[model samples]
Target chain A: MNREIQLIKRPEAAPSHEHLKVVETEQPEPRQGEALVKLLYVSVDPYMRGRMSDAESYIAPFQLNEPMEGGVVAEVVQSKDDSLNQGDIVTAMLPWREYALVKADSVRKVDPSLGPVTTSLGILGMPGLTAYFGLMDIGQPQKGETLVVSGAAGAVGSTVVQIGKIVGCHVVGIAGSDEKTSYLMNELGVDEVINYKKENMADALANACPDGVDVYFDNVGGDISDRVYPLLNKYARIAQCGAIASYNVPNDQGPRMQMHLIKSSALIKGFTVGDYQTRFNEGFNYLSKWLKEGKLTYEETVQEGFETIPDAFFGLFEGKNIGKQLVKVSEPSSN
Target chain B: MNREIQLIKRPEAAPSHEHLKVVETEQPEPRQGEALVKLLYVSVDPYMRGRMSDAESYIAPFQLNEPMEGGVVAEVVQSKDDSLNQGDIVTAMLPWREYALVKADSVRKVDPSLGPVTTSLGILGMPGLTAYFGLMDIGQPQKGETLVVSGAAGAVGSTVVQIGKIVGCHVVGIAGSDEKTSYLMNELGVDEVINYKKENMADALANACPDGVDVYFDNVGGDISDRVYPLLNKYARIAQCGAIASYNVPNDQGPRMQMHLIKSSALIKGFTVGDYQTRFNEGFNYLSKWLKEGKLTYEETVQEGFETIPDAFFGLFEGKNIGKQLVKVSEPSSN
Candidate 1:
């Protein structure tokens, strides 16, 4: 028997049990050039929030009454293709089910020796590459420049903060809670962390970046992004990665930035990891090297069991995740 | 004898007669490494409006109770350096005075055989360089791509519109009046012209750019820029040259553009011509060649008399000029 979670309805704000339903289904069988896999971990990310709605976006919305799909780590239990073995661990964009019968082309083999298999869904995955290209290719933070990262404690933001520091920039992070701020400062070695929830955000950001912002990695947009507007230096670069705060409705925006952009002679570029799919190997290789050298660290708020996947996804908006948020469906077959 | 205009006070909105004063002064003598020049032509630019105010910008604000200085074509009457001689035509950042005593290093000799000595203040000067680099280096208009230019009849904007047409782009122009629109469509060969003052800007823009805007040369950056924001295509480029629309009082701006940028994966680069000062020789050479071949044509709204310089400057804010607005201080001594 296989248990699967489906999107029963679209959520207006915070997703609840009404929007998602878990169902027991028959175990799926594989055909030629296909494999049957048992999911070991399920990843929940903020971009999934964009896919849950019927709103126009880069990617299509998840269909209601169908199984929802996301980044997943699973072990191949039955194989029809000679390339994949029964005990092989793989990563795939598969449905939130205990077992998945998918074509061999859908799954990618993740090396088990690279920290953990779940790292394939976090540091070595989309979030890591998003930070790498968005910051390096676009932001191009120079030495002694002020680099500010909003959503500083999340998977992508934490990685960006470290990269900014390594490149000799002064890194300031903006996060929702004091705990998240502490994580960024203590573990990530961020120069300054603003607890946007408690502090006067604009003042804190201004005080932190007195020389003005040279590069901004915008993750959580709205007030945080608005506050950074007045502080941009000449030729400043903004890498717009995500707008988690406004992902729900997306209507409320602050004052027009063209005047400020004119005054500073700044640049803003929006991108997705899919934009750099050809360069995935470069980012992933460097990321694995950094993880081994202890230059980067990551945390995951892991929920237990397959049924708790929806709860874990909703917890992302509540800021419950420390870095990456994932659900532990089951232990590795070998372990 | 010398008569010059001085800035008495910074203007709140549109400049008035009270903001500037005319003062008659004695002839200035040149010291060692200096030359005495008799002013012939002076340039009145929109950027000077920012200099009149104390607001912090890329360049220093013009000081009050002093003769306002800008791009001028003058004849050297007295020279203390060996390279300079009597009756030499030169371009310099000289005061508004009828005769200016300036350092020999402060001025460069102009080749009148290139086009016109006044062309050094119009098509071959800062406005020309502004259009050249802003459109080529940043906007990068591709062949068969849709390009929209605001303030399309002004100096820099007109040059950009012509360049867009020359580069095999489907060029659409936006201007404030019917006459300006006619000039763009009929003479400049702009594919479409939207009279912004008469039509619904958003609808007209949408109708003009059926394939969506690939490159936008933004010269008037308030509501005009806002209307074009919605019609941006994926990977659009915005070359922000000026904000003439909000030059007087910058408080009234529309909503922020982060969401729209994210949707289209666009890039907006705000730049001043000063940023490309190093590449001036290359652009000037090409511009001179273009003028000789009659590939580019220019119109100058010449304001006669040195005493009427302030009126020509005010004419910029009121949109009275068709192209480059210039003040004729005097006739060139020999040429």
Candidate 2:
């Protein structure tokens, strides 16, 4: 038997165990030009909340009943194609299944030497590339300028905070809890950390960035951004990456910011990693080099067993995990 | 005797004749490096409203009891500098006085061949440079892209519409009055016109740009802009130039737009003409070439006589002017 999680119904507010149904199905076989992949680690991200709904977005909505797809790190158990061999580590948009029979061309080979195969999902994958293009390309933080990162403990925000420090900027991280704030401040060496829930977020952000914010890496958009807008200096730049706050809202109506952008002569640009697909190699080289040089460090919260997949996903909205949230189903037999 | 309009006190809301004091004083003689200029056409712009109150901004607040400064097309009556000559036409930041004693370096000599010398205050001046840089540098409207301009009858917005057309973009102009809408449609050949006051602006805007608004040249930042934000497509660009609506408001609190920018991957950038000082010559040359080719046309609502200066300036906030609002204090004898 094979195990997988399926979206039995759409989430009303925050996703819970009720919204997902874990099922056991027959193990799938690899056809010609395909590989039978056994899941080792799979990612549960904030962006997945958007895909679970039927909202019109950059990507298509996740369909009901079958299986929800996401970035997965798996091992080849069997191969019918020359490109992939048994025991090879790979990354693909594989469904939430213990085993996935996918076309060889659908997945990319991963080298374990580049940290761990798990880093491919956290620091060197979608979240990493999101932080890279959004911060470097759009935010364009200058030395001595102040940079503010929302969702500072999450995968993308943590990467953005480190990059800001690397560029010699005053980095302020906005997180929800004390532990997350301490992790950002003590471990990551972030210049300041504002636990948004503990204090008046607007006043705390202003206290943190006394010189005013020049660049903002916006991973979580809500009241945190509302507070950030009024503190923007002239010619300030905002990289709008994710809006996990309003993803669950039936209608994504939040706040309006035309006057703020106009008055400060500021700039807010939204972008996805897909926009920088052609420049992935450049981003990967820079990120990997920094990781090896000890200039960047990352943390992940992992849950073991295939049965705990839905709870691992629900943990994302509850802020139950720090850094990247992943579920460990199995370890590759050889590697 | 020299006549000039002095700001007596800051107005609470819209400026009226009561806020201004017309005075007759002795004209000062020009010193070395100074020229005694006779004012021909003095402009009363929306930006001046911001300078009236003690608000911290890009430019300092106007000092009370001093004749308010503005764009002036004037004649050099007497010169102590070799660069300027008697009867030479020049453009400078001159007070609302009949005679202005200013440093010769403070003024740029105007060529009469560039349409009209008064064009120095309208199309060939700060407003024109504003439209040029905001549209080209920030908006970056490509060929076949749809562009929407707010305050379409105003100096900066009118110029933006024509340039959008010249760049092969489908141009849409939004104005308060039907007359202004007709002017944009018939006279300027704008592809679409939205009478913001008379129609459902959002639905009209949606109907106007069926493909979706790509570049928005926003001059009036209020309800019109509030409506435009929802209609942005993927990679939309908003050029924030002026906020006429919020200039008088004590505290500038309007909409919040992070979610929209994130969803559409759009861009909103605010700018001033001063930001493009290095690129003025480039903007000027292009504007002049286009103007001479019969591609751009401009209108001015002029009030003659020095005594009418207060009323002329007040007309700007009332939406009484269709295009550039100018106070014609005197006519240049040569031109």
Task: Give the DockQ of candidate 2.
Answer: 0.43
Q: CAPRI band of model 1?
A: medium
Query: What are the runs in model 1 whose C-alpha is more than 4 Å off?
Result: A1-28, A52-56, A64-67, A305-311, A333-335, B11-18, B23-27
* lDDT at residue B279 of model 1 (Cα atoms): 100
Over B24-87, each residue of candidate 2 has an lDDT whose tens digit, in order, gives: 9898898888889999888888888878887556778888998888899899999999888999
Where model 2 places Cα greater than 4 Å from the true spot, the runs are: A8-13, A16-18, A23-26, A201-203, A249-256, B1-3, B8-26, B249-255, B333-335
Displacement of residue B172 (Cα, Å) in model 1 is 1.7
lDDT of 2 at A41: 94
TM-score on alpha carbons, each prediction: 0.92, 0.92
Best by DockQ: 1
Proportion of native contacts present in model 2 = 0.56
